[model samples]
Target chain A: MSAALFLIALSAVLALGLGVYAGRGREMGLEQWSVGSRGFGAVLVFLLLAGEIYTTFTFLGASGFSYGLGAPAYYILAYGTLAYVISYFILPPVWSYAKKHSLVSQPDFFAAKFDSPALGVLVALVDIVALIPYLVLQFTGLGIIVQIAGYGAISKDVAIIIGALVVTAYVIVSGIRGSALTAIVKDGLIIVVVVFMGIYLPVHYYGGIGAMFATLDHAKPGFLAFPASGQSVSWFVSTVLLTCLGFFMWPHSFAACFSAKNRSVFRKNAILLPIYQLVLLFVFFVGFAAVLQVPGLKGAATNMALLKISVAAFPPWMVGIIGATGVLTALVPGSLIMMSASTLFARNLVGFVRPHASNAQTVMVAKFTVPVVALVAVYFTIQGSSTIVALLLMGYNFVTQLFPALVASLMKRNPVSKQGAFAGIFVGVGTVVFLTLTHQTIGTLIPGLPEMIRDLNVGIIALGLNLIVMVAVSAMTPKTAMLPAE
Target chain B: MKNIRLLAILPFIGMLAGPILHNGVEPYILGMPFILGWVVVWILITSAVMAVIYKYDPANAEGDEP
Candidate 1:
């Protein structure tokens, strides 16, 4: 076997071992398994949240985005920093509520807060639908990472199967704790590898970062900045705002807050996480470096720009290290996604249906659901054909529909009736599905609009419609008394 | 406390100002594209702003625990 494949296999084994070991000696109750018994300190919570944030998406998609689309990729950095800023205010209340009620999943928070199990089921459905695509994106990134870095000895399908199995195994055994442990190693390796490649490539190729930008700008004028039409400035601003609202709406991220020891853990992380987001600048640098050095990577293949450039620039052993890092990137977040989805499926969807299932029974259902979810994601990764960025955007459009209802329920009076929350999510998600399937955008839906208005993200339209319907429906319905969170 | 919490809005303005103020590529700030540099600066400013809010927000007071 080549050194690259050997290193990847070794790291996969290490990840599996560490993951299984994390659950050792602890009773794996439903809460213990899903939220680390709600006892994580600031550092672990930080790593867990950061682990979800810097997934294969950050490792590959960010660079590939900058490599393919230029200035549009800057939205990745902008949205995340804003998301952290929003998190500072929102997460404390969420943490306290979840702690007060021992909420294990994102839907649990919604169901309990709205006093409606049907709304929980609605949120669960949206969560699963949105999360599967995101999980598939991670598996696809793993497939690409291994196929390229392993010198093409393994096919993409085989790599995905192997990755899915390893993630499923650890997640079933260790749950969220396992993901958190592996996240420490994953973050450390990714920081070193991304920073080294980001700086080294620019300096090596064109003498320095400044000189590299100068060369690229002269060679391809207007390529590094957003144009006036598609992917324009309006698109960037709207996308950043939409994703900021939707960031914590992600089920794993929402549930991850339930794992923190105190409300202060979130406050501290909000201060620190944006600094962590700055590391993505190196990811963009790597992408920019690839644009000049190893050009001609178009479409979905642009996701390979980071790995391709690294393979060309470094030797086998070095590429092996990078490949290992990529594997951890996919596994850490993939496991968390799987964990969250299964818990949501079992605790909210199934438990709602049965209504009398014991806690241990629910945990069993979650454990069994993990491999099933993994299999579904693996099948989609093999069959699906969109770029990683496209896949993530599709998921975001669906998931962001939950934002309005979530924020409304957090208010002191909880103005939105349960029926209103249901209608809002239904209409919002329906709009996303309709627009996505019809291949329509703001430009096509309404003609004669200016370039700026036309360029706004379609998700913003869904969110706007969602708010209007929610308010309208709530105004017509009898007010539901707000439940005391304490 | 409410006024102090409003400090978080600064990041939203700083970042979303990209299109209006920092859309060009003429003046590369520290070897990066102009918009990219604008974002990097705001990221730092966001951190500093959040740190200030964290210091004074009454939610973090010693007796604030529920």
Candidate 2:
């Protein structure tokens, strides 16, 4: 590598290391590790949330979906931006409530709301399961960027291992604050690179965005039309719902939410998050244009679509900067996932499995668990060749099964049974796994429903079924088995 | 519980209407090529629903107690 390239990598590492050191001690105690000491300001929350939204998939999958799936790929564009306004109001109270209760994970809310540690533990396990593959997705993203950038002396596995190790060290040291500070740089670089590429590539290859679309439309009919290819109207309906409700269920989202310094900060960031997702529109063009320029790369992390473009087009030095940016993007999220997992584990799992554990001990347990989870993710991403879309959906679906009891407590007379929550999650996960295994395109799962409904996203169906079964089983139970829904 | 019911049904009408009235209309907001009008509308309506929830919140007094 050139001196310029080496210097960029060193600075990136140093910037991240400096960030962790700065966050070495926070007076809010465990809240800092789990949720940035619950003091992340408005701008910090916006950047942190944006970092979460724009993961390895935004770069790789959005492009892949556009290149491979056509206009229907716009779901990635629509869902993210919409999440801001939806969450703006929902999150403020949730954050206030979390702070009031000092809640560390989503399951903690469920446990307290429903008055069942068993339910909390079950929810914890579900989040951990969802997070593992999601972490692998990030690691896989890191590997692809490293391999493509030509780390000649360092093999692909070594690059991946090194990246994961660095991320784990920082996360274990400083937690969410570390990730959020780094996000400041990550989002800045991503914006510059995305805008530069979106402008450069379209003009460079096709005359412009108009010409690029025209070529894609001719070559791929119905490219701009709704329900293009295999994405059905039912699928669209289900996906919109899935994104709206389930986006809140992600465990890491709680980590981000709880980090807010105040309720108003949450609302401000929520209203503004759409603008960040709006940036995805530019990144989407990178993918759509790829169809016109270099269309054959499939089975890749959709987030990689951007990095792949950079590596394939720019010279080595520029490619290295973009590569470093991509690594940071993957790194931030990868670390957060493990940190959130460890937080969930110590709070819910150990608290149930070992009731005698103290707060300091729990915090210690969380710090140690980060590298273990990162290694597991690294192992899976390297050994596996599965589709990135499937990897994400599986996590989404599994976590979503917990929605019924969550929403139920907000209203209705139903009491939730621990057995019923378990059944709902297990069945929901199974249904998603079965559907994904038989996926038509990695875009959606949920087979065997009529074509109108089959690709309607398995996660939606899982949530739907989870609610029905939860209500039904709860109805059959005695009052003692139920939580007071109202 | 009635609040949850209202929350479920309220946005649903707009949601159904949205896909029917605006499907395939690419980023067209009142005839402008906004490249993301669906999302823009999505955020607007979602915020509106939350506003409704807030307006009628039963625990408003309790929340303000602190």
Maximum-TM-score candidate: 1
Instruction: Highest lDDT: give the candidate number.
Output: 1
Error of 2 at B10 (Å): 9.3
True contacts kept of each: 0.75, 0.13
DockQ of each: 0.75, 0.22
Find the 10 residues in a row with the least total lDDT in model 2 chain A. Answer: A477-486
Question: Residue by residue across A164-221, what tens digits does model 1's lDDT show?
Answer: 9999999988888988899999999999998999999999998898998889889888
Encode model 2's per-residue lDDT on A35-135: one tens digit a residue: 76676777888777778777876776676777666656667755664455456546765676677777878888777766678778888988998898888
- When candidate 1 is compared with the true two-chain complex, its DockQ is 0.75
- Model 2 earns a TM-score of 0.86
Q: Give per-residue lDDT, candidate 1, residue A348.
A: 92
